[model samples]
Target chain A: MPSVKFIEHNGTEHVVDGTNGDSLMMIATSNLVPGIDADCGGECSCATCHVLVDASWVDKLAPATETEESMLDLNPDRESNSRLSCQIPMSDELDGIVINLPEFQY
Target chain B: MTNIVIIGGGQAAGQAVASLRQEGFEGKIDLIGEEPSLPYQRPPLSKAYLSGALEASKLLVRPEKFYQDRDVATHLGSPVKHISPQERTVTVGETEFSYDKLLIATGGRPRKLTLPGSDLSGIHYLRTLQDVDNIRAHMATAKNLCIVGGGYIGLEVASVAVTLGVTVNVLEMESRILQRVTTPFMSDFYHQLHTERGVHIHTETTCQGFRGQSGKVSHVLCGNQEIEADLVIVGIGIIPNIELAETAGLACDNGILVDDHCKTSDDNIFAAGDCTNHPNALLNRRLRLESVPNAMDQARTAATNMLGGDKTYATVPWFWSDQYDLKLQMLGFSQDADAAVLRGDPGTRQFAQFYLSEGKIIAVDAVNSPKEFMVAKQLHGVAVSPEDLANLDVDLKSLVPST
Candidate 1:
């Protein structure tokens, strides 16, 4: 199982085991994390799963696809490092990646 | 002077902006949105947009010039990064914007399947212009399509697919289609209608995964069964965008928590649309709704409050879904109704299901009958006896005020 570290908006940290093919949004939502609504169930249509990638590892994450990019346009908070967690698939390489939650998703 | 900022470019946000302006508020108005285009309506995305009955240009809630003409500073493609309640500011990228009032109208997204091959090409979720564009291109050549989930989106898309001479198979995890929302009568009516149209429907079946060929979906795996398809659409449900609210120290339960006034924990900030959980006065409890009626009503309330007006959004919630020739419209909330009054024959396809709770009309589910729905909406608070509701000869309009 791939493990990912999540640092919530309140600075609470928790490590959760994620499957290789699951999305970061799914892992966070299933773990009952305070953030990461993953509304739309990992579909890039909704930007509720918006997360700010750890600036240091932003390059390691894949670039936003056209769908994700278009959806991000509707997100409340748009950042250069902002990525829809639903579009970010979990993997061993992203184990230690950190994401910051936005102040409003809907 | 109050500085009002709205974060969204959809119908709800548009309504809020318009309401605020109409209320004669002489304040700073900032409309920050991620969409490059102006605010638009989403209900048509699954229907008219797919059938070419409506153009993309007509979907916009207002013309581009309207924003400038109305003095609404529109920020296209700019996402709000963070909100500092203490500082009364919101950050978008490197720029920090100040606001005395904030409205969060971020909407929901379409739910996707977790099965394998979901990442393959030709899989679609209809929520925006680009999504419609991609699906429209494939729909031109698509012969067979598999729809996972039997909700409104799936059914609406299936209706369009069948009309285009495409074979559609709808797979539902529940025992009946639309099990979560509609009554069994409505569900059976729809199931029969779809089945009669030669649609292949599999109920109580879970999608195991998907099989792909050449990076495109070819088959859907359901337990030990396999169904062939050229396109796949998953419409399980939507999740409210609550991360931003939760992160900002706002109360969230299924959605951003809001009172009747659409106010969040931070009085300076408010929320509406599919991303909010508001107190439904009719239900006497907090509930999250996905209907356009709820969104627009909440928007109005939020706008009034933003303009320093004392108004509460306590309107009865309503929703509608168009499938094939049937238009299902609902009024109020019915999740806890103890009795239901049938106005007409369900088998005939024109009737209204009036849900009653403790001898009062709580909610109504009408199919192909808007007059009854309108009457139900008007008589929402008036106590009507079920015996009178069951009588067909009695004029329902008489039960409530005219107009």
Candidate 2:
């Protein structure tokens, strides 16, 4: 089973087992993890589920499409590591992924 | 601790609860939801949920435990009878709950067509979860579904029906689909897409009445033409639920009117989401928006003011719709635009149409082109000539002025 660690802005961490077909937003939210709003319900339309990927695993994740990049650009606090958690599909290869939820999301 | 009461069981009310908890408001939060279930997403009620691709649990804004854990008392399936602003109490039957602050997020209801045979057994309107459940149940034994309206709801249902192998016929009174909300380019794009999917689209046609058999809708009458239909779905429009605000002596127009801070006429009361007619400084006009983003954003603003924090909601309005794998994202309002420019070709199924008023970008409707929509959202009211926009060499990112 794949596991993803979600770190909140206040340093609270929640490591939950991820389902293969679900997005990170879905896993974090369904597990009652705080700070992942998924206000648009994993539609990739709202960037509220914005997360900063750990620097070490940035190269391993799939690159965001132009549409996803547009949504990320709307976030004022967006950095090179910023990704909409809804766009990242959970898989066995992406286990042990670490994502930092932004302060603005709360 | 203050007693904060929230009315309505839709996205606005649910988001308000989440916002209050996120803001650390440890008050006695009372959520009065008219529906039996928890606050769920309405958008999927027509698409994924209706098609059975999305589960009912996924539609909830938050799990039931979230509210229970926060000590937020929830009253589901209870309709608020009346509100007394002077007494600061909301009445649900004989029970009266006092509140220091109140939020009215009643949202809206679907407008029903009152034609002759409108009360037929097989006719349905897509608004609530129950409404879609009824439609989904009917879809099992129904074929040749007739949809009356070409708006987002109508089109979304048509998409699902087509996927379910149900023959669909869409009747639009307007000349094109989405005439009231989108540009002709977008309308034509969707028209072509749906037509290619084997859905019959009838434009400039009005459903005069329904022809029924045994109190069930069998066919639809449109100016002497009777189209066979085993089931019928109406998605005309919605009327904001504002009777409570009006009865409470708050100002009401087409919807409950609110200022920039989401405060109503009375200081103790606040209104947000689809039930609100709010002033948008960016658009330089007042309008009511029905979208998830609008509901969530205004709920945040209303929660802030409810907690004694002054925050104004003046962001650019944005909306999105998913139909047959195409995602259309619109930014700002495009009403009364003088000119429109096509940024890309619709044949490719990914393009954007920029709406400009007197050489200034007012709004944009992007089809699977989120980058263009993002650029338009940032430069919403900035003056940019159509010629400059048409130039392929010029980057939309460069047009955005750096803060």
Candidate 3:
């Protein structure tokens, strides 16, 4: 199990145990971490699960699909490391990955 | 603190409440839903929830604690009887609630076929969770399921029923399945897919009525042909719930007419979700959409403008459907597209059909190709030749300029 840290826009942090094969959005949302509203249920169609990954771990994670990048493009607070958390599947290698929730997804 | 009343406890209303709180609005929020449950996600009602793959608790759009902690007054099972814009009050049963600003997110209701033998016990329409719960209970003993529409709901139910080892038959009034929404090529693909899965599809078939055994639906009567069925699911379409807005003297044309800000004829009254027909600057027309994304986006826009922010709703509409391991994602509208450029081979079950008009991309329907659909969504109004779009060798990502 990998431990992922999710930091909200208000600077609130939530550390949750990420099981292999589960999405980051799924882990945060199932664990009651605020700000990760996966309204589309891990579907890449909606950008509600957007997260700004820390630059240190950006290269370590899998590259975002064109669909994920398109959703991230819609985010008002999108950064270079912005990614839809649903596209990021959890794995042991991603243990200690830090992500920041945007102020708003729209 | 100003009082805001939002009608219909569905996606739009839920998003409105969250958007208001996120905007730091400390006001009274009264969420009135006709259903017994709190604001829940209806998309999964036909998929996971219908098949029992997902638990009832997972259907909740937000945790129950969020509403309580936010002080949202949720009136479940309480249907608003009337709305008086002059009095600025909404009447739910015997109670009347006053509001400084009101949002009409009443959404829409499933349209039913009005013909002989329409009233039967086993005939169902997919809308609320209670409706699906009823259908699921009947599915336990149901062996043959007759779907009266080839739309999303009807096809989704067919998918679930076939998976349950139930014989499925889809009756579509149109020439082909999904004719109203998708191109012929896309429709043919689905038609073949469903046929290969042991599901029978009847196209250009109009069901006149239903016959029942002991008041339970037993067979469907089409124009001279009778199709045997133990259960029937109707998914023809939905009619917008604009009675409240119409009664209030607000402009009503197909739906509650709202401005770009989502405000109705009455300044203090607004509407969102599938209930409101508003102008889409992006599509260059007025449209009413029934997708979850459309509801959420318009709700946030309505919330912002209600809070003194001068914002307009102009996002490209997108929709999706899941069936038998295939996800069909679409963006924009293909109403007037002159040509459809096929990307990738449909034989692999992973391809995209881009609708283009005079060389400018207008819309795309991607089957199990989320990446192509996402890229096409970003290039909504961009002019791209069909030649480049057809070539899979051309990286679609490079076509979109970095912001």
Interface RMSD (C-alpha) of each candidate? 18.1, 3.8, 4.8
Against the true structure, candidate 3 has what lDDT? 0.86
lDDT of 2 by residue, A12-105 (tens): 9999887786788877865667777676778887677989999998998889987789777756667899999989989988899999988875
Tens digits of per-residue lDDT, candidate 2, B108-132, equal 9999999999999999998999999
Task: List model 1 lDDT by residue over B242-316, tens digit each.
Answer: 776777788889899988889998989999899998887766888877777677678878988877788888777
Best by DockQ: 2
Q: Cα deviation in Å at residue B57, candidate 3? A: 0.9
Put down candidate 3 lDDT per residue, A16-35, tens digits, no spaces.
Answer: 78778778886776565668
For every prediction, compared with the true complex, DockQ reads 0.01, 0.43, 0.25
Q: Please, what are the lDDT tens digits per residue for candidate 3 over residues B1-403?
A: 4899999989889888888887788999999888888878899899889999978876777667778878999999998889998899999999999999998999999998888899988998899999999999999999989999999888888888999999999999989999888778888999999999999999999999998889888899999999888888899999999998898899999999999899999999889999989999887899988888888778888989888888888888888898988888888888779888999998998899999887888899988787677677677888986887899998776676765
Worst window of 10 by summed lDDT in candidate 2 chain A? A30-39
Q: Each predicted model: what fraction of the native A–B Cα contacts (within 8 Å) does it retain? A: 0.00, 0.49, 0.14
* lDDT values, one for every candidate: 0.79, 0.88, 0.86
Candidate 3: stretches off by over 4 Å: A1-41, A55-83, A87-97, A102-106
* Candidate number achieving the greatest lDDT relative to the actual structure: 2
Q: TM-scores across all candidates?
A: 0.77, 0.91, 0.90
